[model samples]
Target: MKKRGIGIAVGTHPAGLKGGGDPSQAQIRLKPDGTFDLLNGAVDIGQGCKTILRQLAADELDVPLENITHQNIDTDTGPMCTGTFASRVTFMDGNAVLAAAADLKKKIRDWAAEYFECSPADVEVANNKVFVKGVPEKSLSMAEVGAMVNWGGKFLVGTGAYTPGPGQQFDPETGKMTAIASLAFGCCVAEVEVDTETGVVDVLKLVQVFEVGKAMNRLLCKGQNNGGAMMGIGFGLTENVCPYYPTMDFAVQDLTDYVITTAADMPPVMVEDIVEVPHPNGPRGAKGYSEMTASLAGPAILNAIHNAIGVWITDYPATPERILKALEAAHA
Candidate 1:
């Protein structure tokens, strides 16, 4: 007989380093052709950091998206980042890029003021053009300005760096300090069907809700949610490094022997929703959201399994053999 059950779990993840003082830096330079090069150390490990960062730069610089080229160069050429972990890229590195763009914008405005013989406050920059306020005719394209700046023996560059909070401070008595710059919270509900006779547990559906501060790119956020859901399912039911417990002997050696969840194992229905609650210190009000996307999936599925079979399978991967053994132990 197959029994069905549903369960929900909530999880939270922090952005930036635990003890604070995490820093990220960025640099931006304008090309003669009016395009921009944004250099940062935040690598895109398939999380679409390049796309979102470009979007941020374009928004800040008041230029078209294609006008920016985001480059993740080596330490020799790019700014320093405290590696990409703890879901810090979107929050920490993004702020660095925004700051760089702002710095670059100020330089452009100052140069335009000099060229137009106007005050920097009187120069207006928008849509890749610089003009004096209330005088649209007295304008020049960004490309033209870039060319003039280069010919004048000057290179336009902007550099910025960001560190969360006012450095790492500790309380003298309690030893507590501000850990994370920001936080992302999420909830996941999972439905599962368990067969008592054969000990097969099948996930039917997964629904997730996340508070991401802001969605930099909605499509990319959806993709992350889907990918995280799949990974969570794998953690709940299929992936195992040590098949033989209590000892490290005869462990699965490679990918060939390892059991994992594939596309065929995904639930039939999956839904992800985003709730935007802007952070005061985030870049464009966006938070670090990558890691929390997958945090609640395993626990939700485990709770569902207990509901279906009335047995708590405390072990990871929740293999059929383990489920069977748990059921036997419960009924005995």
Candidate 2:
């Protein structure tokens, strides 16, 4: 492949000035000592970016997932990144990592074939070993291959880079919007009971259904959706952002009143409720599931409340006072 043979496509927003630029970044270092370092500048933020990239590298190199060490998101050592936002890192950095790993794997296969006097196709690598496909007994570990390479001259190393795809910009004058090069969609349903008198809401159950194209780690995917649902509940019925002013006795009003969803408030989270819709740009057809749970919760909870109280609420954080008022109005 040429130097620029691997071109990755990505999606971005046109609203913010900085958001229209590059989508992802990555770096790879292969040492003669047989140890490798993959520095990914993207932050995980509990979205399993580390696990996902590790899988991509393992799959590309035909190496066991345990063999690769990921040194991720340290600003001092890793590449300068745009950080984790706008759901771009996995798609952008993942492709770059695949390219780098593929290059390294090719080099390894070529060197092994030359050392063993065999065709590259005759060698298979797995669990860090280069083996003759039919004669598994005749094999050399990755450490052996590293020792054979001339490290004093120049060790084997490779790097890959990626940016978001094109056709995402929108006209500033016209209210026209262009579809992102890639799109991911999801739905969630939450069941809650509101105490009419105290305005307390108990989340009885949460069912999140999302299409994540692919699931790299089923456990991590479920965790992300569950966490998003908890946060969504807070956004819908709790968590009010309050600002303070110096004129008001240098105190912030409602600081003590604002609430967030806690372990006690959370119900059973059913992950089977999530569906996997293949995303064209995702690694193995996987898309972002981090925010899907929350995106659908607001409307689901509002509709549920309307069904119970026979009133429609346009505003959020449907407090007890509001519920009581709605109930009174319904009776009157």
Candidate 3:
């Protein structure tokens, strides 16, 4: 009743962002209760930017992760940033946070030295405490230092700005384009069962491999990869915009008219592999690769169909009708 076929595909999505050299900004300020108020203009639209940025901020400040409060972006209150983009948040925005963290660290230590009545070189911060070198007992909690600075001393605030750099302008003569940032690689293998009579495809297994540079947050990484696969499945199977397109007269404008892949439609067997070949220009040796996570699945599924039925369904929604027609045409 079902014929099986296998297909493999490898692809890449350019790192950095869609457009390079965009500027971003981040600000960090200490709170009254020994916590931090981190402000970055990057918006999180279900991509886990808040969690990832919080981790970055916490690492840089030597503070407990729970002590940092990430605030949403406000143009009037927060620093300027390039905003979120297709592939730029993890690399570009993260770099800005790194810059801010570095500035904040330097400021904290400088002030800590002044308060400790020692040279800046003699002060070290660890476990949310600033102490003189070799004297762990002679220390002040981060909040105490913050209160001192905020009440009458210099405000404990730091800001950072980041831009990729002087990029080449587009040239009209010879039409040559300069190289953008490096790319992340995605590899996928799709195993499918094709029912010749009904012209339906049942995806049995999907194996994915990604070169992620580094996994920032493992949970978020899983979310992106798994969610991406579902999106790819819909793209390859039964998702379409205009129901019966060409004419457009019968366009049903409702969610009910659209066929999206669901949990029940997920492949029975899914395998994932992550490769960590850190990129040189990335933050914490990490590049954003979620943009390409689901990219190769569509092509892999199409290749699988060709292998299975010896026919090509060259339409958007590879529906059962299209598959049947392709099979009939191949026979003719």
Candidate 4:
């Protein structure tokens, strides 16, 4: 007999430490060609932080997207940033970039006004041009302003550093702690099919809903959701880093031994809903949601199996043998 099952789980893991003081820093530089550079310490592990940070820089500075070069190479030059983890890059690192952009924008506007012999308020930068308000005919190319600043023996550079708060040391005796700067939440539902005879389980559908503050990039959010769902499936079904028990030997040695779910293993149906609720301190009210749906997938899959087979399997991977044994014991 074939059976259908459904499982659900929630994730409330935070974006960073509660009241921790770890800071993320960024530096902004204006070049003579009206282009810009963003130097930060946050390493983008292909999670799109580079693109997201660059977007923040460009938007805040009122510069063209193509005018900014993202730089995060070495500690020797890159601004200091707390290592990327806990899904804090978007919220923490982003704030730093926002501040840097604001600072650089002010300096650029100042020079733009000087070149026009008007009050800074009279000039605005948009679409890569610094123009006088209500007079389209009078405009200065951003590159011209930069060239003037350079010839005047000045460079535009701004730095921003964000630290949530001074970390409070937890009371050793009471375990009391302060609140975190921000928190991200998500919910996931998994639908699965189980085979009674062979004890094989297949994930058919996965629906995820998340509170991301804002979608800095909609496509990036979707990619993160899908990627997290598949990884969650693997975590619940396969890809165990340490399979052996107390001996601590590597049961699955490497790629050949480890079995991670691939595209073929993805669920047939996947739905993602992104909720935008602006954060008070986050850059443009955006927060991190990269790993929010990941941890929930495994539990939801496990619960779905229980809903179908009516057998509670505690051990992970829930291989065919274990399922059979659990069925036998339940019937016994």
Q: What stretches of model 3 exceed 4 Å from their correct place?
A: 73-76, 170-178
- Per-residue lDDT value at 194 in model 4: 86
Write candidate 1's Cα lDDT for 227-250 as tens digits. 898888888887898888667886
Better-scoring candidate (lDDT), 2 or 4: 4
The local distance difference test score of model 2 is 0.64
- The residue-by-residue lDDT of candidate 4 on 1-332, one tens digit each, is 78899999888766666667878899999888878889999998878889999999989877778889999988567899877888888988999999998888777778777877789888887877888898888787879877877777999898888878877888889988776677778999999998888888889999988898888999999888888888889888776666665566656778866778888998899898888898887889987668776888988888999999999878777666677889889989
lDDT of each: 0.88, 0.64, 0.81, 0.84
Residue 12's lDDT within candidate 4 is 76
Q: Looking at model 2, which ten-residue stretch has the lowest summed lDDT? A: 1-10
Q: Clashes in model 2: which pairs?
A: 10-165, 199-320, 211-277, 213-277, 213-278, 213-285, 214-286
Candidate 3 to truth, TM: 0.94
Better of 1 and 3 by TM-score: 1
The predicted structure with the larger lDDT, 1 or 2, is 1
Q: List, residue by residue over 1-332, the lDDT tens digit for candidate 3.
A: 67889988898887554336677788889877678988988889888988888888888778888988888668567777667765677777677888888888888888877777788889887789878999877798988877777776477777887766645666778766554565788899999999999989999999888888887887788778888888887888888887576878777677677788889989999887788998887788778788787687788888899889888777666778888889888888
The full ranking of all candidates by lDDT, starting with the best, is 1, 4, 3, 2
Pick by lDDT: which candidate is best? 1
Which candidate ranks first by TM-score, i.e. highest? 1
TM-score of each: 0.96, 0.80, 0.94, 0.93
How far off is model 2, as Cα RMSD?
9.7
